[model samples]
Structure formats: C-alpha cells, structure tokens
Target chain A: MSSDAATDIMDGTHSALRTHGYAELTMQDIADEAGLSKAALHYHFDCKHDLLLAFLDRLLARFRERISDVGGDDAADRLLSLVETVLLPPTDGEPHEFRTALLEIEAQAPYDEAYRSRLERFDEVLTEEVRSILEDGVAEGTFCDDVDPAEAASFVVTYVRGARTENVAVGTALGDSLEAFRGYVERALLAPAATSVTDGGDADDGAGDEVDGE
Target chain B: MSSDAATDIMDGTHSALRTHGYAELTMQDIADEAGLSKAALHYHFDCKHDLLLAFLDRLLARFRERISDVGGDDAADRLLSLVETVLLPPTDGEPHEFRTALLEIEAQAPYDEAYRSRLERFDEVLTEEVRSILEDGVAEGTFCDDVDPAEAASFVVTYVRGARTENVAVGTALGDSLEAFRGYVERALLAPAATSVTDGGDADDGAGDEVDGE
Candidate 1:
C-alpha cells in the first residue's frame, strides 16, 4: 500500500475515534470515514489495532515537531512555548479532537500492555524535553539551582496532563489551568531575580493569556 | 435490600471492575463475584450502570471518611494526612485495585454525562477540603497569606489526580510521586517560617517514604 493511502486511512481512524470512541470504533466505520472501500482499508492495516498503533506514532511525532518548532534562545520562553503548545487550544480555537482521541486511546492502557508502553514512551519524550529546558534555565540562572530538573519536569508533565484530563473530562477551561500552572512556575521554579523581573510590575497580571500567541 | 447486601454487591462490582474493566463488566460476572444469584444481584442494582453509580458513591464516601479520620490540630499535618491518604498505597501495600477501578470509571466521563457529573462532584468535595485546610493554615499563620486558597487547592488537586493517573497508567511507583508532590507543597504552599522549621533539619530527607505509615 502507498504511504498516502495509509495516512488517509489513519485520518479516518481519527475521525472514527472522535465520533464513536475506542470502544465503539469499527473497521467499517473507519473505512467509510476515509472514503475508501473496506478492502482497501484492510490492504493497509490488517486490524483496527494496527491502524491505531500507527496513528499513535504519528500523533507523537507531530507533538515532537511542535516542540522543535518553538524558536528561542531563552530557556524560559521555550518552556512556556512547550506548555502553551501542550495545553492551549489551537490558534483557530477549534475543539481539541486529536487530544480527546488520544485520551480515549490512553484509557485502553490498563488492558493492553502495548498501549501502556506506547503511552509511556510518549511521556518519556515529553519529560526529557522539559528536563533539558529546566537544566538550561538553571545554568543560565533563570531557574532555581537547588531544584532537581528531573523532578521539576515530572511535576510539570503531571500537572499539564492532569489539567488536560480535567478540562476534557469536566469541561474545565484550559486557559484557567495554564494560568494556574504559570503561577506555580513563577513562585516555585524560577529564581528570585527572574521572578522579580518578569513579575515585578504587576503582581496579578493577566500575562498568561498571551502565551498562546507566542 | 439491606445496606449490607448493597455493600456486598458494590464489592462484587469493584472486583468485576478490576478483573474485567468497565466495558466488559456483566451482571453475570458481578453475580458470580459476589457469590449471589443473578436475581439477587438484580434486586440490589437494576443494571451495570446502576451498580457502578452505587459503587462510585461508596468510594467517594470512603474517601471523605478517611479525610475526617485524620487526627491532628495542626492544619499542615491535617493537609499532609489528607494528601497521604489520597496518594499513598494502603498500609498493607497491596496493589491499588480500588484506585485503578476509579480511574477506569473516570475515563467514561466524556461519553456519559452522569459519570462526568459524579466525578465532578468527587473533585469538588476534594477541592473544598483542601481549600478549607489552606484557609485554616493561613489563619493560623502557617501558610502563605498572599496565595489564593481556591487556586492553590485546584492546583494541588489537579497535580494529585494527574500523578495518580500516571502511576496507574504507567506502573510508576506511587511513593516517588508522593515525594515529588511533597516537595512542591513544602516549597510553594507553606509559610517561610513553617518551611524552615518543618523541612529544615533534613534538606534531602527521605521523609516522603514515611508517609505511608504516618
């Protein structure tokens, strides 16, 4: 099968996931969504699991590309960009269908070890990115020296994941969550000089809302 | 039905959740797990959703009871106890089957409005408890005065929920997560004097490991 056909089939799987969820996802539905015959879908992916695994790989790669696209020499700005990219809604303000689908896939992790391992690998990449940024910030004297980069990275990843889950599950605003996380980073993670300089003028500024545009 | 029978039925549902997950939980499996007849199980809960609703209510009530059972005059200690109760494994150190089940139920929130509302109620209760404790700590001059209790409570609740999800999803150790959270709390939430005193003697102490027993 051509790579284009596989990509088209995966796009159909994404739509199927958004509409029907993982439990109700069917090969027929995916093929129909893709505008491809069932036989053509089967030619590319032998089973629904195979299609989903490929889709997940694509999703992870897309997230990595977004991270790398963040351009800045300042570690703090890069970290903020990473956070905004992960938590903020798209610039078009469309509903987060892709993230919603990924969460549905993650729900299968407990029953399927392959899903669990794949999700873990995704988290590992995110954690490594955050850790590297924190280390850079510390070396530049922008973040506190005493804090462990790995633990801080773990906390950031956990907080963002939790906030995203809460937003998706309960209709909590992702913007509100990003603001709360920014507060934590300002007070606990950043060095004293950096905090004073960045937040000195306005103790209760609404600067967090500007993160998405950056 | 007697309350005892109801409790027993919920226990059976819990076991069913652990063994088969929510999607595959059947009345027959619940009946078999409870050692009750199918008719008897029907007497307690009309369907799987009814049984799960009852089970979720029981789980929330048990958590509230654990929070109330923490004996301490100090607000910080009470807060720590609450955190420990929520995140730490049981003293017996068995696998976290109940929490695992709760996480599974939460995944259904997006698809089922009833589940979403119930999980929101659970989170509201937890956030309220944390907010009340923080207020008490502030009043007692043990916590920072500048921080908003509601926002801090939200962050803590979000972080804990996220950490629990990560641990359940990826087989990460609950102890390490609890320790990371403790570090956040000690550094970010407590008053400076309290931090110096509570965490002064041992900067790199393995104090988090002792929370399971305390």
Candidate 2:
C-alpha cells in the first residue's frame, strides 16, 4: 500500500475509535469503516494499541506546530496565546475530531502503559512550552520575580486541564469553554497587584478561620 | 440493625470503596474486606448506587461540619479558614481510604447521574461559601474594593480541585502534597503586592501590563 493511502486508513481508524471508544473499537470495524482490507490495516499498524499511540503522536506533533505559530510580545502573552490556542475551538476545517479522540485517549491513558507514555510525552512538551513562557515572564519582569516557572507552569497546565474537564462535564462545546477559560487564565496569570486583595485591604490574614459561623 | 451499627457498616462500605475503584470494586469484596456478612451490608445499603450516594452524602455532611467550625472573624478570615481546613489533611481519622474513595467517585461522577448531582451540589455549597466570604470582605474592606468574592471563591474551589487532582497524580503522601498545595493557594489568594520576589526591588510594573496579542 502507498504511504499516503496508509495514512488515510490510519486517520479513518482513529475517527472510528473516537466515535466508538477503545473497548468497542475493533480492527474489522476500522477496516470496514475505512473500506480497506483487514490485512491492509495490519500492514500499517500491528494492532489497535499501535494505532492509538500513532494517533497520540500525531496530536503532539500538531500541538508543536501550533505552538510554533503562536507568537507574542512577552511571556504572559505567549503563554496566553498557547493556552488560548488549545482551549479555543477550531475554526472551519480544523481537525477537531482528533482532539476529541486524543482527550478520550488521555482520560483512558492511566489504565494503559503505552498510552500513558504517549500522554507523559505530550505533557512534557506542554510543560516545557509553558515553562519557557514563564521563564521569559520572570526575566522580563512581567510576572512575579519569585515565581518558579516550572511549578507555576505545572499549575497552569493543570488548571487548563481541569477547566477542560469541567467543559467536558457540562457538555459545553470545547470552543466556547475555551473562551471562558481564557478569562480565568488571564486573571490567574495577571501580575499580583492588579488583582490581589492584599496591601492591608480587607485581606484575610493567612490563618485558619471558621468556615461559616462568621 | 441499630442506627449506630448501620452507620458503622455504611462507613465500612464507603471505606472499602475508596481503597478499591468503583468499577473494580464489589459488594462481596466490601463485605469481606469490612469483615461483615453480605446480609449486614444489604441491610444497610440496598445496592451499590445507594451506598455510593450515602458516601457522598456523608462527605457533604463532613464538609458542612468543617465549614461551620470557622468563626470569630469577617468573611476574609472565614474564607481563609475554609481554605486552610481543606488544605489540612483529615486528621479526624476519616481514613486515607476515604480520600481515595472520594477521588474515585469524583472521577466517575461525570459519567453517572446520581454522582453528578452530588458533585453539582458540592460545587454549589463551595460557591455559596465563597460568595459569603466576598460579601464579608467587601463590607469590612479587607478584600479589594473591586474584588468579587463570589468569583474569587469559584477560582479558589477550582484551584483546590485542580490541586487535589495533582496531589493524587503525584502519588506522594497526602499530607506533604496538601501542604504544598496550601502554600500555592495562600500565594494565589494573597494580593500580589504582598508576595516578595527573589530580588529586593519590585518589578517595574507592580500591576502587570496587558499585551494586545491574542
């Protein structure tokens, strides 16, 4: 089979997996869905796991490409752009189904080693990108001086992940949720004085107080 | 069964649920693990769903009880207290198993209606608590004049949830992670001007500049 033809078959199989979930997906189902011979499917991928890993690999590559396209004046803007890109819904003709598939794979990765490895690598790339942005912010005095870029980046990524999970929870379109999340992220990353309640304002002192009796 | 005895069995089942995931767990396993007969288990919980709901209900009660313990201050202190309480590991012997079980149930809630209801209610309570805190802060002027306690509280809860998920991911002892998360939360909650940067001098703009880049 031609390489281009094999790539198309792989894409078709990934689409099927997204719609049918991992457990219900089968080689025959993918081949039939792709209108390819079962043997031909095997020619490209040994099994479902290989195909899933490939799908994730493609996702990471796409993310890297988008990151490359995202340019900004400083770390904060760059970080925001990076987040906005992921959180925003794709415009016309963008490969959204792949994202949905990758999300499913990420949710299920904990139970699968190969999938988990792929996800860890994906996470590493994301963290690295975020870390670079944060490092820039600190150097440029755009963010807090003491902010640990890696730790802050980890929290930021986790926050986005949580927001995405929330979006998934309410069944909100990923695109719309991404917009709301951008607002939250903007506040979260803002320089401290811009939004903090400190400076002897009616600040809650850093001590344990009661929950509701006040 | 005596009310106390029934409660004991329920707690036991909930405890077992935490240590074992919902999908991988069984009533028989809970019973065996709890050292109780299947009859005793059924007498307390009609089925798994009922049992799961009970566990959630108990968690809610515990949360309310904890919240109610905060007093002797305005909303800011109370709000901080609530966060502190959440940050502190459950020292009341709630059992590490309970935390694990709660995480499992929380993870599954997105896919289950009853669990979802419980989860929504959980969020509602947290949001309300935050609103109250913000209201108090506004009245007392401890928080910023422009601060919206309700929104701040929402961000706080989301941050906590995100932190909890990360703590679980790292698989370290809960106490240490909780402390680290508490530090993060404290910093995030404070007015930005308060957190000292590594250098003695503050950044050029105490307030962050907004970049027009998207």
The candidate scoring highest on lDDT is 1
Candidate 2 residue-wise lDDT, A115-196, digit = tens:
7676667667877888888887677755667677877777666666655544443333555444444444344454443322
Q: Please write out the lDDT profile of model 1 over residues A105-154, one tens digit for every residue.
A: 66667777888888998789889999999998888876788878999999
**Across residues B115-181, which tens digit of lDDT does each residue of candidate 2 receive?**
8788777777876877787676556644445555665666566655655544443333435434444
In candidate 2, position B125 carries an lDDT of 80
> Alpha-carbon error at B16 in model 1, in Å?
1.5
Q: How many residue pairs clash in each candidate?
A: 0, 14
- Interface root mean square deviation of every model, in Å? 1.5, 4.2
lDDT of 2 at B81: 63
- Measured by DockQ, the strongest candidate is 1
